[model samples]
Target: MILIALLALPALGALLAFLPGRTGRLAATCVAALTFGLSLRLYSTGPGFWYEFDRAWVPALKLRFHLGVDGISWPLIVLTTLLTLLCCLYSLWKTPDNRLIGLLLALQVGLLGVFVALDLVLFFVAFEVVLLPMYAIIAGWGGPKRRHAARKFVLYTLFGSMLLLIGVVLVVNQTGTADLAKPAGTATLAAFVFLALGFAVKAPLWPLHSWLPDAHSEAPTVGSVLLAGVLLKLGTYGLIRVAIPVAPTGAHKAAPVLAGLAVGAILIGGLICLAQTELKRLIAYSSVGHMGFVLLGIATMTATGLQAALIGNLAHGLITGLLFFLVGALKDRTHTGELAELGGLRESSPQLAGLLGFAALASLGLPGLAGFWGEAFAVIAAAQRGWWVAAALAAVGGAIAAAYLLRLLRKVTHGPSTLKLTGPAGYELAAWAPLVVGTVAVGLAPLLVTGVTGPAVDALVEAFTK
Candidate 1:
């Protein structure tokens, strides 16, 4: 019931957001706040599903209207809610378009649904539900190349979706049940491959990642935030929850390949960031590198690796979300994101410069920050699996990450003043403060995330071992 309400509130708000003027915006913000409140009820101690709801939806096909929450999913569900709420609140001042607010809320419903869905078919439906609103968000309100970026984003994802649908169909036909809780009886390697490739495209793993930079560079601020913050999580989450479990034999066989590609993404993404000249595009490329670390953790398929992946997922959501927000604010003020055209941020806006620096440091996986644990543990997990070469390369990737981020700071915040920009707005601070606090909090006590995910990760690893 709580889970239903958690999803329903945003859904209802989305409709209400079509209302006229401030009424719609206020309604959306209130609804978002309420939805965030509802999500809090999902938290619980220990492992396995803390709550579950299942019902038959299609007798003929064995599909069901099933939703469940567990240690592994609770944090993500909460993150989806929190980020949506913050994005909505940020929209109130920055965007103020009722229609945009509506689309954001609509996107929220799909994100929450994905985190809570327990049936593969339902998960796929929730997954696909996100496409149009996001496409609309990017196409309607984005930069000069909006249409091109949106079309590419949709085309790339649609191709991935086709593969995902085939994988889902294959799994369902073989097991005769779409319920993820049930064993995937004799599911083939081909099914896992289809799913992995589909998800990798969304994770926007290197090579398949071309669509991401364009999308992020052209997307509106809120759109970019959601894209980097939680939208990307769907892919990594799908890997953890579906691909590996449903096809363990394939997972074991393909682990090495996944690790290799992940390292490639880490190194390649960082190298690209080092060469990037646009602020938003640079941050966008950084996501490819960061998500690469998360994927590396997943490839190891050990308890340590999975736990690292989970925390890394949450940390990226916090740190990268903040980066996009800050970048958006800077762009809004300077009217440009070009690196050479922007300099001495501290001279014009010390507060914003300080925030950007903090975000940059956190992004670089600085010790005692939210970003540190996941990358460190991912390398450790790879070494644990005796993939020493992959670990060493991933470590180099980390150093490369630090180099690029510091370079970003030097280019944007340390030189002679290029533009006189106003400080961040009150509403902006209101929206950003939580993410800032969350990053620091998680950095200081990773247990806030890890404690919840540990048991669930252990259970999944146990099942995989069997």
Candidate 2:
């Protein structure tokens, strides 16, 4: 019942968000907030899945409405709810059209469903649910190139979806069960390749990532936050949730290739960030690098590596979501995100500048922050797995991450006051403060996340070893 309600609330809110005036917006925000509280409460009711619900949805096809959560999906569920709540709060201050609010709530439905889904068909349905509303969000509410960016996003992800569907068919045909926990015979390498390519495009790894910067740069603030925060996680989450567990043989064979791509993204993404002059695009590219760390963690196929990947996913959601919010706030004030067009922001808006500085540090994997644990542990896991070369490459990528992020801080926040900017607004602070606390809290005490995700990773690793 809790699982069904958790999945249904946002969807119901989507229609309610269309109600007239501020009432609709308030309803939307309340729905998101309530969902967050519910998710947290569900997680807190001891460890493992709380709202266990399974029902036959498509008997002829062997599909069921299977829904549950373990350590792996629990934090991500919390993340999706938290980000949605924050995004709703941020939207309240600006008060976009009621329909946009509705779309956001609708988006939340898909995101929440994806995390808890225990069946592949269910996961795919939830996966595709996210596409339409996001497309509308970008195309309708984005920047000058919003239409182009939105279309590109659809094309790339849609193509990826086709591959994903193919992979799903192969897996289902071979296993005859949609339940993720029930092991199937070793999936063929082609099935794994199809799945990896499909997920990678959404993950936007390396070459497949070209659409992300444009999408991020053009999207509305709420759209960008959700995009970076949750949409991207779907891909990495799929890799962990589906690709590895179902296809261990294929995963083992492909580890080196995945590791290589991870390194490429780390190095290539950093270099690209160094060349980016626009703030949003630069941050978008940084995602490519940060997600690289997550891929590396999974490639190691060790408990520590999986733990690193899970924590990294949470940290990236917190840190990158904060960065996007700050950038959006900065852009709102300056009317531009060009590094040269904005300078000495700290002098004009100390709070914004200070938050930006802290977020930048977190993004760069500064020790004691949330970002450090994942990057540090991923490399350690890689080395322990005897992928020394990949480990060294990841280490180098971390140094470059620091360089690029610091350069961004120096250029945008530290110069002489070049623009007369309104100081941080109350709502802006209200929106950013949680992300700030999360980054620092997770950094200072990584155990907050690791403790919950560790057991799941161990079990996952054991499955892979078998």
**Best-fitting candidate, measured by TM-score?**
1
Error of 1 at 213 (Å): 0.3
> Residue 129 CA error for candidate 2 (Å)?
0.4
Cα error, candidate 1, residue 384 (Å): 0.2
In order, the Cα lDDT scores of the candidates are 0.92, 0.89
Worst 10-residue lDDT window for candidate 2 reads 42-51
Root-mean-square deviation (CA) per prediction: 0.8, 1.2
- What overall lDDT, based on C-alpha atoms, would model 2 receive against the true structure? 0.89
Candidate 1: global Cα-lDDT? 0.92
Report the poorest 10 consecutive residues by lDDT, candidate 1: 177-186
Stretches off by above 4 angstroms in model 1 are none
Query: Which residue pairs clash in candidate 1?
Result: none
Q: Residue 75 lDDT in model 1?
A: 87
